[model samples]
Target chain A: MHADYLWTAAPLIVSAPMAKVAMPKLAAAVSKAGGLGFIAAGYHSDHLEDLLQEAEDLLQEGTAETPIKVEEGTPKFLPVGVGFITWSASLEKALPSFSRYCPAAVWLFAPPQGFRDLIPWATRIREATACRTKIWVQVGSVSDAVEVVEAIDPDVIVVQGLDAGGHSLARGASIISLVPEIKDKLQELRPFPQKQIDVFAAGGISDSRGVAAAVALGAHGCVLGTRFLASPESLVAHGYQKALLDASDGGTSTVRTKIYDKVRDIHGWPEGYDGRGLINRTFIDHLNGLSEVKNREMYREELKRGDEGYGVNGRLTTYAGTGVGLIREVIPAGDIVKSLREGARALLYGPHNVSKL
Target chain B: MHADYLWTAAPLIVSAPMAKVAMPKLAAAVSKAGGLGFIAAGYHSDHLEDLLQEAEDLLQEGTAETPIKVEEGTPKFLPVGVGFITWSASLEKALPSFSRYCPAAVWLFAPPQGFRDLIPWATRIREATACRTKIWVQVGSVSDAVEVVEAIDPDVIVVQGLDAGGHSLARGASIISLVPEIKDKLQELRPFPQKQIDVFAAGGISDSRGVAAAVALGAHGCVLGTRFLASPESLVAHGYQKALLDASDGGTSTVRTKIYDKVRDIHGWPEGYDGRGLINRTFIDHLNGLSEVKNREMYREELKRGDEGYGVNGRLTTYAGTGVGLIREVIPAGDIVKSLREGARALLYGPHNVSKL
Candidate 1:
């Protein structure tokens, strides 16, 4: 039941669970390249059985890019790590399918409404799966994190900063400020040797320096979402990837708001949660919360006109962190793992000149 | 014309040119510790001569806490660097007083208005004072940077990120993103051997990690504003400093808006500029921009009832960066410089574990 993959994952890197972006190929590639890779299990509660079945198939017949290699010295790529939005109907629908498939780790994002019952749900997952999956809960604030840890006592807690791409929970605090703040808060707790809790910093981190910075800031590791969005193995449409490269830095194009989600009709996300993406004409027009008759209809037309991330109206949602400016070209998932490892290693142990990486 | 301070200021730390907060004692302490410390020459346009005279006395007599030391193998702590808010009536009012003291560097903050003629003004300073001061121009955007560098050819260009405490020029970008963004923008220029411009990252950077992070982000150095404001030598009132400490992490207390400046009745600042500080009852009550008469009087009455950085109605305006939370305790100014230098050096060149610092 003890998942050795948690400590065995080399480079201490983890691919973020991005909905509609992280696919099996990307997850497999990251795992093969010696980092923990996750399959974003949000947004598709109905298709949980099919997705798990596909994961089983994908595990058997490895892709052309990279196969899951759990060799000696190499990290033991646990069964696919799946993340679910806590309040989503995904849990109820997928409850039947989860017992059949063993996940290396299961990450749960607690919503504000049902957050109190999160521990019960986590208990269910652990009980249902015979405690095979290591539980990781993501928290946005100092207070929420302490509460969750006390209740569920999960294996890992991700301290999500405000600069995170979608649904940041950090109130107004940044990663540089939030990580230490959370660590300081966590330090006050009495020793819990029975449960070892590792903390990960998530947000605008895009490169090797970010990895080093986060580690220095007391995070056991870092979870990067935006960087993985640009990986080739991601499920994003080709056109969307092109748009990401076009709006690479994202300073001029990106704005954080709930408008994109409103236009897309992606409901059920909790309040206080918002998305950061390339600002489009539709977003600009409908930023004040879309009205059903006038603006929503106009937005539907704009959405239908585009197959790529962009239409004539502008860009579709491409959720990204503020560090989007650091991304240059879309590379393979394995390459992302490799480059991040090399870069972090260089900054942490190599010469002082990190820019050369 | 050759200022060794620019190249030889070891550790590459700068006490920010914070008006009212930075005084002779603070500047001298930073300089004594082998970093560039600047006396803010904004707001008090008419008193430049007296300030320069004070700087002369402060340089000679020094403070009991820390004294200016020009030791061998260390920076000479050049003629105290003085910064002026470019549009302030200070220039016209203090032109006669400028030539009386030869400052090591005259840093000019480019005002949004009349920014075009900043070069001519620099030329006039060079002509009148016979080029005794190395001119430094602070720029906000990439386009503004290109224009300024081409026109004035300043010795340094500080990429002011949006997280800077005071008025910042960065267009919706944080320092982690903007420093590299500006560096990339500057790469397009052909060799301007006559004047090579060094870039400094300024904004939310709160600690030694920020120093290492900035250097890794392609900055020649990093400028700290909020961190320095907490120094024992800062001119902030005891009550205001208490408020700053209470609002320390800055997340709960601070909001970036022009309303604070408007309330303070501080004028001569350009349009598009705003202040970031601890939000008080005044900001919450009159967030829609203070209407005249009644509210202004209430705010004035509220401002008077404070000693340290706090008042009965919360805080007046504690200008702060997003990293205000990083400050744990107020120590001497030289200690900040020493700690930042040691911490950054450890992270950059020493072992990977930096949290021990």
Candidate 2:
């Protein structure tokens, strides 16, 4: 079946499941606006039930209309998806939640044993949910996409480039090249007239222009992390939001490094994966040969400052992609999705459309 | 004037002036196929007259139907453009050729003193060509585009991202983010109803999908470097072509480094600029702690082997972007341009167009 059947939107827009940041409100708001929203289950399953329940309650309250397309006779499941840092999250711990609330999809990323490690998680989740939930795997390099597809035959593949925020392969091309390459390779492997696997472009995408561009790059949809960070529904601190707003040339202002994870003592990320964030004192100090212990101490001090600790001078981590510069102000999550969809539609199909070649 | 007036194509396509590789034949072939083409002037003015003369002869012979549109009352000038490695190519040495041929455009890149260094070169070229030659400046960052625009008010700005092959800023985002960011910033500076500066995307663009994506990302056009390398008209060696064809997953097989320049003894590139090329024993050996002298010695030995020296195991450089994996065959440059144009047209305007959002 065409993977687009899983979503109701024409150009599927997805809010990335940024750990601790993407929560029930953000997830539900996106789904309410005709896009897919995901909750970051993170490395622990302790809070997944509560998050899903909150999303369910929000959906039931009918605060906003949802556009999620549920197949006839399908079992009850949350419209929102759940993501995990597969390297640190245990499948056993997450299986209970998967059995309870079969999210529309399960996004697996950064497995320690490479894509093969995701096979078990995908299989168990399928079994637990009776295949109700779709399997989505994120990959940076084409090899990873190939490997993952061969192993799990995932329903969706999110091709994330090096310009992405949080963690990704340290070495990978951008979506301009990566998306089409992966799409072509997958098409060759599966050929046409087979069960088509949907491809979503992620990283460095902040607005409608990016969504339209990703669609032109042969992606069926787009996953946005940094853009959603500017939404009120996201569980981001005020200071972090301000930093993202104040940031202007993110290509230079942001960098990919393990310093944020190191200072936070989050060491379980597999090799070749590093987080992209604003270049601040923590990173500068690390570059200047400051000891890890001293950096950590400063970071702890900044953390106590609450909203004040996440600017250019602040030591707190402000995870963002290179597209952070495009984010101007905080808006409602539903508005972000609606605006992107309308803007992309105009740009792609308007009278002045330049994409007509 | 809108930059589209400078060429005759819809969804304007341009062949990148890859030094030593992009010759008159390739440039003329692209122009013949209804797109703009550029001849790389390299770092010297010695053979410019001969190159321009040969391109003129080719156009006259009409081996291919020329589609380059010439404006009424425009001074006699070659339809193709010329590019310079601004840091090393002296304006005085190149002015004679510029005055004689009065090329359609002059593309400037990698000036040592930054974009300001291009001021004199642009001024003199305009003076020599009586302001007929359009100016195109290549930049890798948003700041650089802003700086160059403020300095020269170029007719076109080529936004080269980090995924580009050949020399470019070592630190920059991919075109997925860079193109629209530059486009927005330039619009903010120039506003609407002002002389609109056309923005073209360069980097990791191999096929029609990339062109469509660039247009969707707000770029007025696209510049293809690696894709053209697979064309028969490119000055690439047989071994280099073979390696490019054999290469898959270019994001992992290629790397950006100054080691190629270091080994070749071509050190004129300014700070923050580096070249991306296929990784081989030369780079591997250097990574393994091989001394510069030892690496150079091995490079010299490999150079003697001619075409045999350019492969995964060989030490010779094969400059290509991250889209190398998509280039499978060596076709005629005209065919490449036509195919890309038609394919992009189909993808962007076909009945199955998914970019409609």
Candidate 3:
């Protein structure tokens, strides 16, 4: 089943699973647009199962009364997937019920808990469905990627560069440089047959040009998070969305930082993890020499100023990529997929078309 | 004259003017391989005229004695170019004698000295030869790129990403993401009669994969550095070359850092500039809790252990890219260019060829 899907069902665009941002509506919208869409299973430690169940039910809500027999190799949900912070303590408890949601595939990120532990999760998913549920592991460093291929054998290895949002590897390589390196390493591992691992690029990719670049850089596909952050279906509040749109004029507006994480009272990311986002009030204040403890105390009160307890309104964290400058509007998720597909097709052709470029 | 060169003389590969590393032989070899090649005019404050004279004479040395009356758009020195740390204290001294070199183009990096200041330098070149000697300004930020286009009106804009070796922008965006954003902004500036500025991607680009990716990301061309560090023509020391080869495996052997600058006794890098180099013994020692001053003291001694009192011995720096892991051998510069050009061609075509990928 996995072989069939990997061979035929690959899509040109895939929406990254964003915690709190990627919900059922966004995932379904993207999936419906012939792109893989995923719900990020993060932060909702105890209620993850319930959230997954809700998302799956919402995805299948419009199915025909007499379910048509699904074709082999073709996706039942088209492109619905689930992503996880694999290092989260909640993963062990959340693992057993994942098969119930019937995700087309699972994207596991930041497995600092070690690559071997991922074996049990992969085994469980494969065994539970009695069908091949694809396993994709994200590795920040090439060593970890090698370990994944040798130990667990993931269908896809995401080479996460230093320029990503939310939780990024503390010291990661640039995506374009890292992808080909990883591909070469994987080839050396399985010489004859050649390790058939698809490499997906993430970090600083926000537009059709980046997508096309990924394919050209020997990646099977690319995942976008910050670009989708401003899509209508994303849970980003109005204030954060405005900050994103305002930065579209071109400047050093966003940066990779650990400041927001400290102010948000979020704690305990495994060693070597940082976040990227629009440089907000808190970051500037901290850079200006405000103490971390004092900044945290001030942010606690400032958080109450906004409608929700999160945003760029006061000292809130606005997770985004450096490519946020390119995002100008909050359109539907499906429309983003369509525009990206069309734009990439237009730019990626030969000289006759690229001359205008 | 500028339009003719930009149109007819476009090449598939180009060697960047790397400080200290790029020499007469390396530049000439790259140009002979159908790629633009450049000599870096670095730290030659007193003998600026003499060095340019030597480089120019050397570049034209092997030319046909019956000089074929160079065509209008044809390069006088073929593909020979000269680069400068534009903000250097020596640029004023270097500027007056640049025409002597008869360069195809001048690559100016890190103009923190302000974009407007670059105009007189550009005007001087045009006046020197009564022809538009194309001016190229390196920018780390979009605003600087816009400034260069609108004010200085450089014929080419090199997007130097954060992953590049040697001196780079303080807080720059990734190359892939920045290229498209700058392109969009330039389009808005000259909407109808489109601004025909070409984008060149630099930083972390090693093999043909990076070149293909750059073109797909809207770059007219790409520049390579670390990959060429191992090229026999490169002037890098034996110790540095060996360290580069040993690190050609999957590991975090390189990083973007500033520690090297301090240890090397190099000073006065305008506020935000740093470097990307191999994580050598010095990096490991400092990480193990040595004080910054003590680390510097140790590096000073370790430096003297090598042939030229430099290298990866104990506390020396090996300036390179995050893709240093991809460089394995010390081949000829022409072979490196050939392989990169061929590899990029194969990967950049449509699905008919990429299916095996």
- In terms of lDDT, which candidate is strongest? 2
Error of 3 at A63 (Å): 9.8
Ranking 1 against 2 by TM-score, winner: 2
Measured against the native two-chain assembly using Cα atoms, what DockQ does each of the candidate structures obtain, in the order listed? 0.33, 0.68, 0.51
At residue A188, give the lDDT of candidate 3. Answer: 86
In candidate 3, what are the lDDT values of residues B229-310, reduced to their tens digit?
Answer: 8888989888778877877532266666678887777777667788877776777777787778998888777766774443
Model 3, runs deviating above 4 Å: A1-11, A61-79, A193-195, A249-251, A307-313, A349-357, B1-11, B61-78, B192-195, B249-251, B288-293, B307-313, B350-352, B355-357
Q: Give the per-residue lDDT of model 2 (tens digit) for B1-357.
A: 324344457777899989999889998888878778899997866788899878877765554354454332334578888899888887888888877777888899888888999999889888888887889999988899889988988988999988888888887799888888888898789776366678889999999999888888888788999999999899999999999999988788889999999999987788888899999999999999999998999999899999999989999988889999889999998888888877877777878776544
lDDT of 1 by residue, B133-183 (tens): 678788765666777877877778887766677776423556555566667
Query: Whole-model Cα lDDT per candidate?
Result: 0.68, 0.85, 0.71
TM-score of 2: 0.96
- For candidate 3, chain B by itself scores a TM value of 0.87
**Full-model lDDT, candidate 1:** 0.68
Candidate 1: lDDT of A136? 86
Chain B, TM-score, each prediction?
0.88, 0.95, 0.87
Q: Rank the candidates by lDDT, best first.
A: 2, 3, 1
Clash pairs detected, candidate 2: none
Q: DockQ score of candidate 3?
A: 0.51
Candidates 1 and 2: which is better by DockQ?
2
Ranking by DockQ: 2, 3, 1
